[model samples]
Target chain A: MSATATIYLLTAAAVFGIGVYGLLQARQILRQLLAINLMGGATFLLLITLGGGADGPPDPVPQAMVLTGIVIAVSATAFALALLVKLQDATGSSDLDPPDAE
Target chain B: MIALAMDAIIAIGLVWLALRTVRGANVFSAIIMFIVFGLIMSLAWARLHAPDLALAEAAIGAGITGALLLVTWRRLQVLEGSVPQVGAETRSLWLTLPTGLAAALLIAGLGWVALSLPAEPATAGELAWQRLPEMGVSNPVTGVLLGFRAYDTLLEMGVLLAAWLGAQVVASEHRPGALPGPAHEEVPLVGALLSLVVPISLLVAVYLLQAGGSAPGGAFQGGAVLAAGGVLLCLTGRLEAADQASLIERVVLILGLAVFSGVGLVMLPLGEPMLAMPGVWAIYLIETALLLSIALTLVLLFAAAPGLRRRL
Candidate 1:
């Protein structure tokens, strides 16, 4: 693999790990969403990096999939945000559980 | 040398900002960092020779998603006066340490396997590139999306539309007005800025849609740009939420799926395979429909409303 691919591949791994940690550690729904998005980014990076090398243009298939993934992420995120707002409205709290939960 | 340096910088930036984005001093700051991270990611995309992905990342990933997040944050604030921040869940060191070690091992394994995997000589990617000429779209990515993988694109549009519809079903009906944007008085320059920016964004959106067939731009990027224009109008108070969607609004919302599927299914009767683009013109037709639907869906999602209309 090219140095560029190696750099991003490792980065993608670390980023995914961090995202897992974030998801586990998060207290708010919004933070969890952010963490999820971070993981999504890592996956996209990994897919594209693996799709091509340093020498030539990347594969169009992965590029198209990643592009589609980006759109779906935003849609899911937007819908999740809307749900978050409503959750706040109905329950009067934005955290997954009440802030007092152990 | 400089290219490698830039790559390293972006990679490091992504890691650092990602860390901050998840566990910053506050959620608001985390959001800001995430937006920055997205912008840097676009740089990474460009460096990777995926200008198509780069444009989509900037406009949709950073621009639309960031705006949605900020607006959601504001709504949370307005509802509760303050969003509670509980610090990271406290856990025993015994548990945390072992889990951390496992995660490290997992990541190492993933990276190792991914890097070590042998490149297949004749992959789907190679096939797609080889078939690009027959697909009628000059751009391979466009060919893959609208030609080879039309099903995926159609499903993506369905997901976007469903998300918008889901948001409508889930949103509290109490707020008929657009979920509050930053308060802005109608300054004279605001109008002047709108006159210039809105039209320019519209023009750019169309340009992107046109260029997408043969170049990097496409329905998603163009739609996001157009949505940004709609967002600008919303922020400046030139648009307001409606209790229900107008007929035109509803029609435009479904145009992408309707037109795309219509064109695809029509192929079967003619003995052509499903979703086989009859020609470049069909791509243009579908992209325009997709551009309209995507732009409207995003604007509605950002607006968090069933519909929007001129402020008058």
Candidate 2:
């Protein structure tokens, strides 16, 4: 791997680690969503960086896959936000854990 | 040297923003941080020579997703009179330490693997690059998305449609005007703004659609840009929710999925592989419908409405 790829690969791993930390610590659904997106971004970065480096003909396959992935992430986020709003509407709370669990 | 510096800056920025997004106790600020993180990520994409991804990340990843997050935040605020949050400020030291240890170890292993990958290994990318000319598109990325891996694109459209359907089903009510759109449709200066922005976005979206055949633009990016216009109209109260979808709205929402699958099935009878582009022209045709479908779907999702009506 080239220097650029090396930089991104390490960066991706670090970012993924941060995402994991966030996911474990978050109880709010929205924060959890943000954490998950961070992980997703890291994964995409790793995929593209591994596919090719800064120079030469960039790989199209991984680029296309990441494009598809970006769209998928948005759609999933939309649905999740809808669920969050509806949960708040029905129960006046957006917490994931049950009320009795406390 | 300069390129490396830029990359380093972007990498540090992404990690920092992600850190802020997750660690901040305030939800609003955290969401804003995440949006900014997306913007920087787009720059990183451009640095990587994936201009198409840069556009997609800017429009879809940052633009649409931020709007969704902010809108949901508004809804929660209205319902609860304040935001609701649950969870410990941080996991206990015992749990956190172990989590940290595990993450570092895993990442170290992954980093080693990534560093060890052969620099110039033969792969499908080389094959795709070779046959790109036959795919009837000049842009290899678009060619792959529109031709070589069309089945994936088809399934992604299906996923978008399914997600919208699921949201509609689970939504508690179809309350029209429930969103935080302005109370009055005729807010001053808003009309002038729309006249300017709407047309520009329209031009840009179509230009992007046309450019996808040879450049970095595509149906997804164009559609997301187009959706921004509709979102503007809805936010200003120009578009209101309706109890039932109008004929045009219904057709527009399904246009992409229908056109894509229709072409695929039609080709089956002719003994062509499914979703094979008949020619260059078919790619453009499918992209236009997809542009419309994706635009309408995103706007509908943003509005959180069953249907939409233009308020005159």
Candidate 3:
């Protein structure tokens, strides 16, 4: 009910929406990666905010999970980027497929 | 009250930036924005009383992730003129608008529910708190990470190592051109800055690892501070990436996981719990190794170079 909590939640929602939008609109493989990362960031924010209390130590579980999530996200992102480079090298196109198809 | 308001505003700004990064017109700009967003999120975590998360997010999220993005962006730039194909599946207004609204509604509902939940007995946090004395650390988060829920942390490190291996498998033989080359004669101000920052980073990193047993600092924070030092050198062109990793570099990279696993495996025959570090000394030792490895891995990942070497 605090205005601060409301702001964090709303921002997180908007970020998720944009990530969804990017996943739809981006034509480049790299762009898609960015979108996915953005979505991940949004989720992290949501978790942290939700864990926060009006007057207590924040929920330790979500904080721990988010720490774990950040590591996972970076590792996965690095692997994905490496793969993207390889894919482009193997194929002439950085864009794997055209935007017309779902 | 003011602190809460400030934290809330910053958090909102971060989310807004995340959205902008995703939907931005220029891909490069979006990546930059995303890094900034990650940095702000680190601040938010600090405000929310999750210093461990703050440290990890800043290092892995903003630092390592940003490096990965920039490297990929550069590689894609090799194919000039032609735009990299993005996935073009557009959502209908009926789909997108509603989804957005629904997510908002869900988050708001969840937040309210969470706020309303009565603090009760038998909370898991309480259990962790109760057991902290046994873990030999005052920090509950550290206790959870290295004591109670240590399996998660162990698996998380595995994920990091696996990702590194995966990257190696997919690595391009044609090395990306190092943007900043080493300078023989130290430039004015730059050298002074390096002298100041590098030592400070090292101090902070060690302090973090040592303090983690009782405070917000830990291996992740320490590693990041170390990596920041590495990054400083890289930016100043004082460091160079080699075709092969040196013996020392390899040792540092493997040290953390090795010590941790070795201790755990060794203790198995001794009739001790797996990864149940014997004392605060073991915890510090394991953390030292982990901190070194984490720092090395992140720095190498950032440079996108197989091995880092001192500039001759």
Candidate 4:
């Protein structure tokens, strides 16, 4: 059981690292959005793993919080996507850099 | 042994999907990969002993978020094609890899220590368990969200509302009546598909809400499910986006907040805590209202329009 938790945590950490690397390299706004979401998922995983219990059932508090975080993530993402669409329409470029760069 | 293997497989798959999401050759594939990553994360939540989290992740994280991403991807396609540039800028190994490695090390150390710690001698979780019966909810997670910590839940709803408002503020003055790419009419068999999916999703949303009082479901989960149904309608052209928010849309958007604030105000004279649920009945009543308002808000947000109308 303890070992299972460790594997989960490590997996989450690796995902977080990959998301961060992607965020760094992402030249497109859409890819960066996906990376940010991946990072959020990793953080949720980290919270749940950290709140694990060895014997009794897992903590309900963290579970509830993570649940809230998931919904909030989607809401934020939806708004962000809307912003992306509006931005693309305004500038004709999905990349956020200045128009002069083109 | 089997458990370990299952864990290993799922974990590796999740990381792989995350990597692919970042590295996918095109924006469309990257969005697809991100959706898969969300689904895998949902399964991981279940394995971590969090069915509530799993349900929310699958419904909201993977399902609704996927819809939003795909919609954005389609919108992006309209832009005149720009040649892809692979690496305009590169960071030194000293700059990038080390921060990632350090984050991993810190997380690993924290997990090991967390596992080794004997136990919380007296934790809020223990207290929550002991008080669960008093909350009159079978699901401890639900109880915490809507009963004991109702304040936080209320504020979360506010955050969602605020996000919608912020989006509206940033919206262009001449909001596009309908998105440019093929109006919903051009899709093949979309009507029949939506007729089936929309109702079923709504039913599931209601069930999730009702069951939430006693199980691994709640307003947020139910609302997301409902939003999914709306997404299907929008995709199929059964529902059209509107420039001006309808009167009814505005009412439903504020229903949850209104009901919540009303309850708190009504109870204030009695000298109870603001927003303190008077009893189990009040809890259910508020949850129902919250569920409805949340569902409507999510659907409205997804439509990216003020109102929706049945297809002509």
Best by DockQ: 2
| Model 2 steric clash pairs | none
For each candidate in turn, give its C-alpha RMSD to the true structure in angstroms: 2.1, 2.2, 3.9, 3.0
* Candidate 2 wrong stretches, greater than 4 Å: A97-101, B82-98, B119-122, B174-177, B183-187
lDDT score of residue B171 within candidate 4: 69
How close is every model to the real structure, measured as TM-score?
Answer: 0.95, 0.94, 0.85, 0.89
The weakest ten consecutive residues by lDDT in model 3 chain B span B83-92
Q: What are the Cα lDDT values of the candidates?
A: 0.88, 0.87, 0.74, 0.77
**What DockQ does each candidate score versus the true complex, computed on alpha carbons?**
0.68, 0.69, 0.48, 0.54
* lDDT for residue B249 in candidate 3, whole number 0-100: 85
TM score of chain A per candidate: 0.93, 0.90, 0.88, 0.90
lDDT, residue B217, candidate 1: 97
The fraction of reference interface contacts (C-alpha pairs within 8 A across chains A and B) present in each candidate is 0.75, 0.80, 0.56, 0.61
* Model 4 lDDT tens row, B282-310: 77777788888888777777767767777
Ranking by lDDT: 1, 2, 4, 3
- Per-residue lDDT of candidate 3, residues B189-209 (tens digit): 898999999999999888989
Poorest stretch of ten by lDDT in candidate 3 chain A: A93-102
- Model 4 chain B: which ten-residue window has the lowest total lDDT? B83-92
Residue A73 error, candidate 4, Å: 1.5
- The DockQ score of candidate 1 comes to 0.68
**The best candidate in terms of lDDT:** 1
